[model samples]
Target: MHEVASQLSADLLGSGGLDRDSGLRPGAARQEVAQRFASVVADIASGAVQFPLPGSGGTSQRFAALRAVAQRDLCLARLVEGHVDATAILAELQEPSPGPTERWGVWAAEPPGEGVTATRTEAGWRLEGLKQYCSGAHSCSRALITATAEDGRRLFAVRTDGPGCEPVPGTWQAIGMAGSDSPDVRITDLPAVPVGGVEAYIRRPGFQHGGIGVAACWYGGALAVTEPLRSAAQRRPDPHTDAHLGAVDMQLHAAGALLDRAAAEIDQDPHDNSGSARLRSLRVRAFIEEVCSATLCHVSRATGAGPLCRDLRHARNVADLSVYIRQHHAEHNLAELGGLVARPENTR
Candidate 1:
C-alpha cells in the first residue's frame, strides 16, 4: 500500500504538477507515465503487491481488501487516466498473463464500424482492423482486445510491440484525460493469443466487480479535489463556505460508507459467479458517481475560480474527475440496475 501510494504521488504530483494541456502532445508526458507504470509493474512482479484472486482465502476477504487499497491509491489512477483499468483487466484474465514488466491495455470499445477481428494464422491467432479507446497505447506493452471471431465475441491478448500494431496520433482529444493517450489502435494481422472463448470477457463476474473498482478511483479523485474546500472551511469563518463544505462532506461520507458495505458484501460471497455481483457494482458506481458530481459542483461553487486558476494539482484533479466519471453509462446502467433489482433471485 505504501509503495503504491509513493508511485501515485510521484506520478501525479510530480515536480511541476499537471495542467489542462499537460499530456496533449504525447512525448515527454508519455515517458513520464510509462516510468510510473514501470514502478508499479516492478512491485507487482516482485510480489510486493499481493491481490487475492477468487477463492484465495476461505471466504472472499482478500478481494475486498485489495479493493480498499485501490480506492486509497486512486489519485494515481486519476493521474495516468484509465491505465489502471487495463492493468486490472490483465490481472483478472482467465489465463495467466505475461510478467509484470509487460504492461497491458483493455481495448474493447466497439463503435458503429468494422471492429477488430481475429484471424487464424499458421503460427497463431492474429488481430486485424482497428480497436478504439486503446488507453495506455504507447506505454502498455500488451493488450487484451475484444474481436469478432467465428462463433461470437472473444478476448484476445496481443503484444503491442508487434510490427502490425500502431497507435494513431491526433485521435484522442479529451483535454481532461490527455495523459491517458487513449487513441485508436490500428492492427494489421498482429499475432495474438486468445485468452478465453466467446463472451468470456463480459460474462465473468469480475467484469462487474472491476466496474466498482473504477468507481473507487473516481471517488478518490473527487476526494482529492474536494480537499481544498474542506481546508478552506476549516480555516475560514464564512458561513457559505462552511455550508458547502458540510454538504460535500456528508456526500463523501455517505459514499465512503456505501463503499465499505459493498466491500463487505463482496467479501461475504467471494466466488459469486452469479449475476448478484451486478447489483453491488451498479449501486456502488452510481452512488459514487453522484457523490463525486456533487463534490465537484460544491467545491467549485464554494472556492470560486481562484484555486482552479492557481492550484495546478487541484484543478487537474477536478478536470480529470469530470472526464473519468463519464465511464458511468448513466441511463443504460440505471436501466440495467432496475432490471437486476426486478429479478427476484436468491432473495436475502
Candidate 2:
C-alpha cells in the first residue's frame, strides 16, 4: 500500500499534476485536488494507506502519504495565492458530521490581555485580544481565536482581517519547521465569524488525531534523519559501527510500530479516549524521541564531528530532528504516559 501511495505521490510530483499553473480551470483543479485528497483519506480509512511507518508490507504506508497530501495542498495553495488552514481542514475531515450552525475554531494559546471581548456584530463577530502561538496563522484565511467576551464567555473564530483584527508578525524562531511561521497575532475589535459552539472544538476526533498526526510528522523526521545514516552504513561498514547502526535500526522499527498501533486505534474508535489510545500516542512519541536521540548520537559518534560541515545533509537532519522533536507535547507526553502507567488499572 505504501508503495502504491508512494507511486501516486511521485506521480503527482513528477507530472506536476498538482501545479496551480497547469491552465486547468480553478474549479477543475479544485476537483482534481479534492479527488486526490479523498483518495488518500479513503486509503487511510480502509487501512490501505497505513500511517506511522510504511514498510513494504500489509501495514501500508503511513505518515509519508498524509504529509504528501498536506504538502501538495500547501504547494497548490501557494501557487494559487490562496491558503487553506490545514488545521481546520484536518478537523473537518476528522469530524464530517458537525452541525452546520455550530461554528468550529481551533484557538489554543495564552491570552495576551484581560477583559478583551469577542462579540458578534452585524457584519461579523468583533474580536479584541491577542492570540499567540498561531501555527498556521500567516497562511490561514480565517482564525479560530479564543477571546473573552463582555459576558465572560470565551469566544472563538475571530476573523483574521475583519475590522480591527490584525495578524501581528509571528515570533517563531525555531530551528525546525521554520516554514510553519507560527507567530503571535493581535486582534483588536476585529469582525469575525463564530465557529462551533463553545468547547465543540475540543470535542472533535481531529483534536486527538492531530496529536497523532504530529507524532507521525516526527516519525517522518526520524526516517528522514535515519535514511542517510542507513545509506552511509551500508556503503561503508565497520564492526564497531555496525553495532551502533543495529541499535538505531531496532529503535526506529520499534517507534514505527508504536505509531502504527496508535493510528489503528484512533481510526477504529475516534472517540475512545481510552488509556490504550492515549498510551499509544504517548508511547509513539517517546519512542520517536528515543529513536531520534539515539540515531543522532550514534551518527555523531560513528561519523565524528567532521560531518558537521555546512554542506552535510546529516548535520541538517540532526539539527532539524533535534528541534522538531521538542514540539508542544514531548516532555508532557512522556509525563502523561508515566501518569497512565501509575494508574491502578494500568498496573493490572
Candidate 3:
C-alpha cells in the first residue's frame, strides 16, 4: 500500500500537467490519480491492506496510509505544490464517479456551533456566512454544506464550486498538517445541486462514513512523526530519553486500537452511531496529539537545538501536524462524544 501511495505521489509530482491552469480543466492525469486513490481506499476497506499495527502505535501506520493517499491525490491535482487550490481538487472528486457513489463528504463548519445556511437564488442557491475549518475544502468539488434556510430550518448543499470558493486569507497558520490548507471559505451566490433534501443530507450514511477517513489521515500523520522518533530512540543510549519513548509508544498503540475499532464499526454498521465510534475517534485523535507533542519535546530535548538548524523536517512535521490536528469540531466533537457516552442510553 505504501509503495502504491509512493508511486501515485511520484506520478503526480512528476506529471507536468499540474500547474495553475491545470485546475481550470479536469485532465486525465488528475482523474487517474483520484481513481488510484479510490482503489487503495477500497482495498483497505476490503481488508486487502492491514491497518493498526498489532502492538503500540499501530494507528500511525493507518494514518500514514491515509495521508499518503490524500496527499498523493492532492499532489496529482497540483494542490500541494501550490499550483492549484485544495478546494478545487476536492470539488473534482465530489463529482459523481462511475460506480455507485462510495465517496463521502467530510465537512466542518466554523464557529464550531452555528450551522451553515443556503437559500434559493436566481443563480442556483446563494450560500452566505462562514464555514469554518473545511479540510480539503480547497480540493473538494462537492460538499454537503450545513446551512439554515431563510425559513430558519437547517438546510444543506446549496452552492458548490471548487475554484469558485476562496480561502479566508491568512487564517490557517498552525503547527501541523500545513499542507492540508483547511482554511475558512465564503460562498456568494454560487450554483449547486442538492444531494438530498435538507434533513436527509444531515442524516445520510455518507456523513458517518466521512469521519473514518479523517481518522485514517490522523493516524497516518502520527506514524510519520513517530517513525523518526523510533529511530532516534534506537540510536540514543540515555535511559531518561528511552523512558519517554516508551510512553510515546504506549500512547500510539492505544490510539491505534481505538482507531481500528472505530474503523470496524464504521465498516460493519455505519448507521449505528453507538456513540462509541465517535468517541473512539475522539480518543484516538487526542491520544495522537499528546503522543506526538511529547515525542517532539523529547526529541528536541535530547537532540538539542542543533537539529532544528540543520534540517526542518522535525519542525515541519510539528507545524503541519499541529495545524492538521485542529480539524473542525475536534474539541466540540470530543465533548459531544463525552456527553453521549454519559447518557443512559449511550451506556448500552
Candidate 4:
C-alpha cells in the first residue's frame, strides 16, 4: 500500500510533474495538474494501475488507493475519483464501456444555478445550458453529465472535445482545489447518449457506495493535513501538541475503522439487498466529514499560522480539504439522515 502511495505520488508530482513550489502561476499549475491527470489515466488504461470497483470485496483496497492519491494531491484525486466513478456508473447501468484511452468525468453537480437541459432531437439527445463545477472541464475527453429532460432528471454521456461544449473561462476562481480545473461549462446543443432512464443515476445502489468512496478521499486528505502536526510533535515533543495529536489519532482511528466496516458491509451486500446502504453511507460520510473537520482544527490550532505561511504542501492540503469536504451537505444531510432513522421501516 505504501508502494502504491509512492507510485501515485511519483506519477503526479515527480519529474515533469506538478509545480509544487507555489511560485508557479495558476494557469501553469492547472495545466500541470491536468497533464498529470491525463498521464495517470493513461497508466490506468494501460493496466499500470487499477482501482477496484466499489463493493467488489476489495473495496478497502479501492479506498486505500484513493487515499494514497489524496494524501499527495487532492486535485488529482478528485479527477481520478470522478473518472473511476464514471466507469463504475457505466458498468452498473450496462452502458457501453469507455474507450481505451478516454478520460471520463462525472459532472452531476446540481447546485442552484442554470443547469444543463436535455432535449430529444430527431437524431438523438441534445443538451444545452451551463453546468457548474464541472471538474476536469478542459481535461476530460468524455463525461457523464446529468441534465433535466422532458420526463425527469437523467444521465447522459457526451464527448467534450466536440464543438458544442465550451468551458466558460474565469468561472472557477477558487483558491483552494484550483488545480482541479473546475469551471462552468456551456453545453450548446451538444449531442449526447442517455445512459439510463429518468432518475436512474441517483436511484442505483452504487450511488450510496460512491458517496462512501468520497468519504475515503476525505479520510486521505485528512491524513495529509495531519502530517505537519505529526512531524512537529516528533521534532519538538510538546505536551500541548501531543494532546492535539492524541485527539487527531482518536478521530482518525475511529473514522478508519468505520470505513473498513462499511467497505466490508458493501462487499457483503453489493446490491443493497439489506436496505441499509443509504443510512450507512450517510453515517459514514457525515462521520468522516466531522473527523476531517476536527483534524484540520487540531492541526491548525497546534501548529498555528506558521505552516500555512511556510509549508506550501500543507497549506494546499488544508485549503483543498476545506473546500472538498463541503460536498457533504452538513445540516441538510443530517436532517435527511434523521428522517431516515425516524422512519418506521428503519426502526425494525
Candidate 5:
C-alpha cells in the first residue's frame, strides 16, 4: 500500500495533474481529485494494492500509506482516508465488506446544526434531513453515515445513488481542500442499513485508531509544506533559514516517533483492553496538530510569500493543510483529553 501511494504520487507529478495551471478550474479539480481517489480505491479493491486494516498488526504501514498520499495532495488523501476508514469500520462491526470497485465514505460530522435523522421503518431504516461535511459527495457510491435516532446516534450504510439522496451544490466554498468536495447533502426518505447498535461507531476501539490515521495525514501535509523551507536553506544556507529548518526537523522527528509509538500500541491492544486508546489518540493527535501548525508557521516565515505567490502546488498545500488540520477540534478535543487525564486513576 505504501508503494502504491509512492507510485500514485509519481503518476500525479509526472502527469502534472495537481498543478493549478494544469488547465483545471477549482470545480474541475474537485472532480478530478475524486476520480484520482476512485482509481486508488480500485487498486485497493483489487490485489494490486493491499491497504492494511487498522489494528491488523501493520498499523504503522497503514499510516505510512496515508501519509504518503497526503504528502502529494491533501484533498486526495482526505477522500482515500475516508474510504479506508469506512472499510475498517465495517470490519470492526463484523459487517460484510464493500464490493470491489465500490467507493465508500464515512460521513459522521455533527456540528451545531440540523443533521440527518433516522426513522425505523417496517422495511428498514429511512434517513432524512441534512448531513454536513459530506466529503466525496459527488463520487462515493456508498457511505457509512451517522444519524440521530429516537434512541441515540446510530451508524447507517446507505447507497449514495439511491433515491432521496441529493448533493446540494454551492454548499462547499473554500479554496483550501476545495477538491475534497465536502458539502452539505440533503436526504429525503433515503433507505439505509443499520451498521451497528446506537453509539457503536464511536464506542469501538478502532475509532481512536482512525483518529490517529487522520493525524498521519496532517503530518504528511506538514512534510509537504516544509519542503520550501528545506529547499531555501539548501540554496542560500542562511543562518535564519537553517535555524527554521532545524526546528522543523525536530518537530517532525518528534511527531513521527509519536505516530510510530501509537501504531505499535494499537497493534498490541487492538481491542483496547488497556482502555488507553482514547488517551493515546488524544495525545498523539494534539501533538501532531501542534507540529503541523508550527511547521506551517516556520515554513511560511522561512520561505516568505514567494512560493505562495509563484508556486501553485505549494500554495495549494499550505491552504489545504490549514483547512485539513482544523478537523482536530482545537480546544474541544484538548478539554476532553484533560477530562480523561483528570480521572484519579489516570493520573497515577
Candidate 6:
C-alpha cells in the first residue's frame, strides 16, 4: 500500500533493466539486488515498504505485493523468497534475532551428496557438509538451513559470512535464474543455532502457505509474457493473433482470480489451521503452474520468436518464468494431491 515499494518496482522495470552482460552473470547481479532489497526491507519500519504480510493487509494482500515485484524483475522476486520464508520460520519458532538490517535465506534444498549434519557442541550446534541451492549465499548474512541431526530433520539459523561458511561459486550453471545466484555452499563446521526441533520445519503451518505465495510470483511472470502478444493483437486484427490473445487473456484472468481465491482462503484460515492448507496449496500451485505454462506457450506462439530473439527483458522473463514454474513438482505433486483428495475426510 505504501508508495516506496511501488516506486522501487517502477524503477526496476524502467531504465533500471539489466544489460546483457549483467543478465548472464549471476554473481554480479546478486550484489546489487541484495543491497536494493535490503533497503526495501529496512524502509518498512520507516513506513516506506508496505509488506502486507505482518502489517495491515493479510495473506491475500501479500500475494499482490509479491506478484507486483515478480512482474517487474524475476531476480528481484527471488530476493523475497528466502527472506520472507526465513522470517516466518523464525517468528514461528519465536527466536530472537538482530535488527531488520540482516537479510536471510532458507536453504532447504537437499544437498546431492552429504547432507549438512548438526552436532551438539559446547558453543552450540555446528553444521558440517554442503547445502545445495543456497540462493543469496553471497548477499544474505544469515540463513535458515535444514540439516540432518542425530534425532531427525531439523532447522537451524547460521551466519553465512561467519567462520567456516564458504559459498561455492560456479556451482550454478543454468542460464535461466542465474541471476538468482542459487549456488552450492560448503559449510565446514559452520556454527548454527537450532531454530526448531527435529521435524519442526516441515510440520510448521507456514510451510504450505509459503508454497502458495510462490504461485503468485509465477502468475505475475505468466502475465508479463502476455504483454507483447496483447500489443500485437491490438495492432492487427489477424484472427489467429486475436485467438491467441483471447486465450492468453482468459488464462491470465483465471490465474489472477485463482490467486485471489487462494489468498482469501489463506487469510480466512491463517497458517493452515484448518488442516486443509496442504490440499489448497497443492491445487493452487498446480493450477498456477498450468496457467504459466499455457501463457508461455500461447504468448510465444502468438508473437512468434521476435521477442525471444530480440528483446532481452521479455526473453529473460520467458526464460526465468520457465525455470521458476519448474519448482512445481508436477506428477509427484499431483500424486500427493490425489492421495489427499482420496482421503475420506477430504472427500467429505
Best by lDDT: 5
- Arrange candidates by lDDT, highest first: which order? 5, 4, 6, 1, 2, 3
Q: How far is each candidate from the true structure, as Cα RMSD in Å?
A: 3.7, 8.2, 8.3, 1.8, 1.7, 2.3
Candidate 6 local lDDT, 104-205, one digit each (tens): 888998836877999999988889998888888777888899999899988988898877888886788777776777888899978888887889998877
Score every model by TM-score: 0.85, 0.68, 0.64, 0.96, 0.96, 0.93
Q: What Cα-based lDDT does every candidate model obtain?
A: 0.68, 0.51, 0.48, 0.88, 0.89, 0.78
Quote the RMSD, in angstroms, for model 2. 8.2
lDDT for predicted candidate 3 compared with the true structure: 0.48
How many steric clashes between backbone atoms does each model show?
A: 0, 10, 34, 0, 0, 0
Candidate 3 on 221-282: residue-level lDDT in tens? Answer: 55555555567678877787677678767776776666556555555554544545445545
Q: 1-348 in candidate 5: lDDT tens per residue?
A: 244456455764334337554324678878788878878888888755556898898898899888888897899899999999999999999999989979999999999888989999898899999999999999999999999999999999999976788899899988899889899999999999999899999999999999999999999899999988999988887999999999999999999889888989999999999999999999999999999999999998888999999878888889999999999999999999999999997997
Candidate 5 lowest-lDDT run of ten: 14-23
Location of the lowest summed lDDT over 10 successive residues in candidate 2: 75-84
Worst 10 residues of 4 by lDDT: 15-24
- Pick by lDDT: 2 or 3, better one: 2
TM-score of 3: 0.64
Candidate 2: C-alpha lDDT: 0.51
Kindly indicate the candidate among 2 and 4 with the higher lDDT. 4
Which residue pairs clash in candidate 4? Answer: none
Better of 3 and 4 by TM-score: 4
For candidate 3, give the lDDT of residue 47.
52
Better of 2 and 4 by TM-score: 4
* Candidate 2 ranges with C-alpha deviation above 4 Å: 4-62, 67-107, 111-117, 120-124, 148-155, 158-165, 273-276, 328-330
In candidate 4, which residue ranges exceed 4 Å CA deviation? 1-18, 21-24
**lDDT over C-alpha atoms for residue 143 of model 1:** 75
Cα lDDT tens digits for candidate 4, 1-348: 233455465635553224665324667667878887888888778877778788887787778788887877888889989999998899999997778789999999999988999999899999999999999998999999999999999999999988999999899988788888899999998999999899999999999999998998999999989988999999999999999999999999999899889989998999999999999999999999999999999999999999999877788888889999999999999999999999998886
